[model samples]
Target: MTRPSNMREWSARARAAGEAQAEPTGATLIRGARVLDPASATDRKLDVLIENEHIAAVGEALAAPARASIIDAHGLWLMPGLVDLCARLREPGATHKASFASEMPAAFAGGITQVLIPPDTQPALDTPAMLIRVQRLARQAGTLDVRMLGALTRELSGAALAELSALKSAGAVGVSNAAAPINDSRIARRALEYAKGLELPVHVFAQDAGLAGNGCAHEGPVATRLGLSAVPVAAEVAALRFWISLVEDTGARVHFCRLSTARGAELIEAALGRGLPVSADVAAHQLHLCDTDVDGFNAQCHVQPPLRTRDDRDALRAAVASGVIGAICSDHQPHEADAKINPFPLTEPGISALETLLPLTLQLVHDGLLSPLQAAERLSRGPAAIAGLDSGRIASGALADLVLVDAEARWTLRPERMLSAGRNTPFAGRTLRGRVRATWRAGRAVFRASG
Candidate 1:
């Protein structure tokens, strides 16, 4: 999947705008890199020219413009910065674990420029003011574009619906209950119907509360042998069935978040076959780990929708490769050391995953399960499309959100070197390939890894 950059030649208007600035306003020339832009199905050695906040031009041997800063990206890979849809930033609530200030850098370091801030903050994103505050905090982190998801239920209590319209006006990209279940069918139906009318997509974490009651690990041989409370795959199946039924009945666009089971993928595929306006994403970790990884009560492997069997992991990978699952996210929930230091069941469930996203995604490529373009699609175009965001492209006139990767570089995930405050990653000490060497947002250098 390689295409010659057919971008128009750089113009005088762009050069004039660049020269008008008192500062250098120099264009950035990234040369000799293998550009993998899935939006255009492009994968080849090329040069990219960035001016102001957009890509000026992209092609082989693109000429260096006046006052341009050249980044010799020989032997590296370049692609659109990932748009992560489920990065739960612990801000305006649990700063002790990780704040927007901390996670934003980790996001950038992982080649993520745009991230969806889930609605489960301390005060929740029920109020426009709370959403505004979270957005503000994220913006202050420099070049990280954060889209806020308004609370689907007031304070995510699953009782009263939040001011979805107000939150929309206040810049919410979507609405979600954020892991909270609306036990009442009438209220849930009304919420979906109302949100559909408002043209807002609903992000749902499908899990039957009762079925998953007190479950800390997936119902499998691993959990049984470990004597852990088991969360059966039925929990996810029942919950997804519930949401898909609503999507079909209400004609509401719904996104299934962090899908964990093979049965869940089958259901999502069937719903899509029926032409329901539905989408799905899996956390990067789920595509790699399974319940077996939880052996020895490794608290770091603990996560909601607890890791399932290897068959389930394989099914998920197949879904992504076949486009049945269109997106993959970090599902980042950074917790303090003490939060995960307790016994497996007592510890908070989540992985400090912002920094592992790119490497793990690239691992799928290395495994030959996906081509480079397919990998880029899952990381960028696919997620951006789900969020209805104007991102995840590397063509002319596209926002200059991009990452330069040392695709051949192998590195160990050392907790001390991580940017996120939470040192609770299961990938810690694991050697991963495809390191993010540098990242840019809106054409400005934001993160450059020290070799």
Candidate 2:
């Protein structure tokens, strides 16, 4: 087989390889591994056989043919690769901070086989042509499976709706304004109504600019004691209420992104209880950190919808456990070193997330907030469902997106070893228990940790 120079060609070769009638390809047997599939409620010691780009079989003590390659997994956990609902690649225009080529490896290393990139770049992906360009770039980069979210409004200005139908046809899994808020309720209603007509899901980050003002930290004692501007929790609650009401009126499939407040989750739960077609997600950082993390002006702790109080953090975790919040997103915003050079309030609000997503989530499992199977559901199955993708599962004939994790492995996060161009992670030097040993995308190994 000839090596492909670009991602498009690489995909062609892979497809052709899968289609070969008489190629007699060798199967890969992952033996003695604990197979965990949250989608099917499966948890048992089993062997997985992968042939080409699909799973061949999954059962106990599976037979391996002479032409098969065997990997001993005596104590490892094999599960579906995580599906990230929100991540910032910073490509096309913000390569100084991150690009698909850089962030993809980091994502794979963290056991994320698929990610949905938001349209928040310098030149937003509002047009079909722009979406095509990004898809082409991702294919050429050939790191992992990446799908772009088309901008809900043109250039994400939230002024007028973009061509949602065209963008969806161009391979946008969904439409979103990302962190950009639509101030005009009329425009927001129109966008949702249009999206409902097209049967496309709209993902939004709810924030009331008027209520948030210039604040960077959550309005609480921490902010008061630290002498930083406060963004009241009311900002999130009010925005969520407005969006949910719009969903009820328009019957649109809406997804709330990066929800940070306790009251915010309560609002979402109430909407869900009312049978409104709405789903929501909380960033992994928000599940662990709180306003106190920014007490000493720590810029890394500063993030959009800034970390709320401990009560909020606990509520978010409980929401995840109770199935109110279905997905966990990295909200992986990567920024250059200089972006966080200023004081806490002046610095950019984000955390370098891809590399730390998995371990941090495992921390939840250790704390009894979520079980291993529940963690897998929130990390993989839930996100996949939200994105309308047929991934994040391990089954017969399913796409072989899998990850091998050592749940007891102890490791420390170091900025020097990160693959993302942005090194502004708050988890630096934090010791984590779980670690990714290997990640496979479509039956092909994409990442392997160092021995």
Candidate 3:
């Protein structure tokens, strides 16, 4: 499909794709579930009724509608299905590691109904054609809502501005360079100005190429002892300062992705305090792990914005608690086993985190850092506002996208038992509390775990 000139046309194409996400099926009633909707600050017992593709009603016990399939939700927590801001579904060319068939269920099992993918896929999503292809492929997956982030530079090469207007018209929610670097600050300023004109938010990775050169681990005592090339915290802090200046000057909205440093989070908090039209999200894994996790050259812990000190992790947790970090995402990048089988420095950096996003976020609650309501806001509502998606809520007339969670259920993470095709997860074999009992999208059950 060619790039349209306006959003109406783009929206029409989106409607076409959404047609496959659900049929106008019969009604369903979830009874006696403790409903938690962070958007409305709602937390109470409610019986939710679903008809067709939207929530028909939500209140105390309403008589079940005729022909509705009734679910016994006693002791279950019914909340809006998660909206993950950063999840890499390896489609369009990286099927050697993952595919829509594998990752979709992984997302559903984790209670994720929507995902925002970056532009760093194989071949990169730099054109309207590429956007349309992923949209079509997601429709075929039939279990997830996918939004694309357009490449800030053509092919994410950090050279020239891409077709930003064309990308917006083709349904890109925002633009980013992904994990790739913007080597030139002049180019970064131009990007913010250009996206501002179109009102598109620029997603910043916030790491300077010069400060982060060829490093495999965080510059800390741990890396020094391990004899690994070290990446200093200044790499993230300097890049964030430059981008905040651009946002302040250009009046552009910028969302920092996977911020991994304490001082960088302080900079972002200051930017927000000054009302600079800036926001930020942290990956869930960063809040729990630190440079210490890489002590033995464990490749599974290798990630962009290499995990820093325990103090940094504590500060990040506090930031999220104090509302400095607006969202928590899974910086999920899946790789084949061979990709991580080599020597530590040579191994690709990432974690197959689709199945662990929600559980990890809930961990903050278990640790007394974030309340359950705060977790819902960070995981669902916060990312929704950042991406400008009309989702991440449960109310009358809203889309019937929801998750049934057994918040007290205990489970173990076994890569071999995971639905994701890639078994490259650092959380493997760890036990965790809370599990998704079922996931529904547009009034139809996408995934329901067997008892």
lDDT of 3: 0.86
Q: Considering summed lDDT, which 10 consecutive residues are worst modelled in model 3?
A: 1-10
Cα lDDT of model 1 by residue, 74-112, tens digit: 999999999999887777777656666666667878889
Number of clashes found in candidate 1? 0
Q: Write the per-residue lDDT of candidate 2 for residues 35-122, one digit (tens) a residue.
A: 8899799988899999988899999888997778788988999989999998888878876677676677778888999999999877
Q: After superposition, how far is residue 261 of candidate 2 from its true place, in Å?
A: 0.8
Ranking by lDDT: 1, 2, 3
Q: What stretches of model 1 exceed 4 Å from their correct place? A: 1-25
Superposed on all Cα atoms, model 2 deviates from the true structure by an RMSD in Å of 5.2
Clashes of 3: 0
lDDT of 3 by residue, 294-346 (tens): 97889999998899999999999999999899999998887878899898999
Cα lDDT computed for each candidate against the true fold: 0.87, 0.86, 0.86
